[model samples]
Target: MTLYSRVRPLAFKLPAETAHDLGKRTLRAAQSTRPTRAALSYAYGYDHPALEVDLFGETFPNPVGVAAGFDKNAEMTHALAALGFGFVEIGTVTPYPQEGNDRPRLFRLREDRGMINRMGFNGQGMERVKERLEEDGTPGVPLGVNVGKMNSSTADEAIEDYRRVFDRLSPFADYVVVNVSCPNTPEEFDESSPEHLERIFETLAAENDADVPILVKIGPDSPEESILELVDIVRELGVDGIVATNTSTTREGLESPEREEWGGLSGKPIADRSTAVIRAIAEHTDGELPIVGVGGVDSAESAYEKIRAGASLVQLYTGFIYGGPSTAKRINRGLAALLQRDGFSSVEDAVGADLELE
Candidate 1:
């Protein structure tokens, strides 16, 4: 086991968010020197060029990427990239910072291998996050900013909230993700609804002077039909791509004591459901729109399933928690082997290869 694996138990002793912060800080601290960079390159580098993927006008070194909400403030992009993620989407950042929910808001369910978090988009504001990115410079890999509304922003004001963040961070981002499907928010303001989603997208897309690729990050709670409807809207509006799934609210398949916790559910419980949604999009989208498959991806098999189903690229969050620091390398290596075994030359060619099309 690696050092991270050995210390994971101690890390897990803290609240999930605290343990996450500790890990992020550790990564950030380790990345400040040259020796660390060389060591990380040695530990995590994958030499296979066939894992390359070009999506939304960007070329990713591989399909495996780090999802948002892990580095909610864009603090560790360089460090994460050093560890071998092909791309890193940082933050569900808002125009303003908020503390999110109170403590005990995060819970771990080891038995069923899941986590529940009502963190409520708690993060540093866009300005500070952008500063971090500026100081660190963009990661060697493609860097994306995942923008969300401030906690206090009303649904009616959603477009304004998203607009400001997009304008501020767009210049520094290779791409921007408008997050409309965070499950921890209060009810009666479902931003993921067709009406709100359109308004939000139109608002941000209009103000995009950088005209950087803009993506929509949806939640896994969406029913299959709902997913297709959104995909159609995204394509119609010319949204760059869909980041297929945030976290699920349904405890539909989780079997843990903390399953009773009220928050967004991620990790293993979301695997099949998220993958099914991605598959439906592949089938319904007819290979026109691209997909960034998230949710329940902690292994090469799961990541490959998403790729074969239709994802041009894949991202993960909860898996890192369970897989420890070397998780990206492990999965990337496994993906390289799987790609050769499956007779595919590159990740781009693997996209949508398994859809049951007419």
Candidate 2:
């Protein structure tokens, strides 16, 4: 009864952005070639070695990624890394093409599994996602890029639109988020203001010069003291992590009548408020920065409860549009059997292990 749960009831009868542009044109034609991307990596690859994960400097063969608006213009990064995504963030990408927010603006709360787009940062930008990542290359795992800023940019032209999509996709990024908390764009300023996130982390830490790794996506309806004052202005601008959440205008316990669709609000009713904003930014950065969590991820006990509430990594787009393609090999083989049933040997020794039982 799989096969995308029997074709997701005929792709949930279209118009959720046209069944997400016909599932990214069938993952851009099953990643065009190479024996059908090695027959989708021998039918949905799922590596184990306790699902390895190092973090932004690469080495994430697991940590269940695939977040940024589901392949927005970087068209199916190697068919979502041959469907067992261990990384694949694409874009909010802006610095040119946009045409967003109209035509039924994506909605399908299918009895609250959730989804209510308002895709205002619509893509096909950043030089066509940097010429489709220099003609289909960057995916053998880690690839994030989420950069955004052009819903009629202001606030000083949104810092040169995130310095022109992080100077054209940060050399095909292994890390680079910087999406000022999208609630479906256009608020005309104060994009998480602390002086506009310190002029967007001091202009992307001075155009980063290949120091890449520069995360920051935040948004779960704020107030945890304004999200710890934007995580102390993202740890006083040395920024290199934090993507806790980025979709939710909050519809409160929605039962789904497209719950007054305005925008944002991603899967499974924003899973426990995006794991309580990744356990309040991992108990206020005591776990020392780096988070990546993402809202209401789909399985492995909700991505092992945001890697035990500190999320060394996690991401999902409406649970791979309702757990299809063996949803990251069934959530990284149930997160390596829930990290060896909790004795934990890897996944970075179970991230925060429920914040050392508080």
Best by lDDT: 2
All-Cα superposition RMSD per candidate? 1.4, 19.2
What's each prediction's clash count? 0, 1
Where does candidate 2 have its weakest 10-residue lDDT segment?
A: 349-358
lDDT of 1 by residue, 111-222 (tens): 7777889999888898898788778887889988888887776887677888888888888788889887888876657776778878887887788766799888877776
- Candidate 2's residue-wise lDDT over 150-218, tens digit each? 888788998988987898788788898888888777788788778888888788888888898898888
- Model 1's alpha-carbon lDDT is 0.84
List runs of model 1 lying over 4 Å from the truth: none
Give the winner by TM-score.
1
- TM for every model, in the order presented, reads 0.96, 0.35
Model 1 poorest 10 in a row by lDDT: 185-194
> How many steric clashes does model 1 contain?
0
Looking at model 2, residue 248 earns an lDDT score of: 83
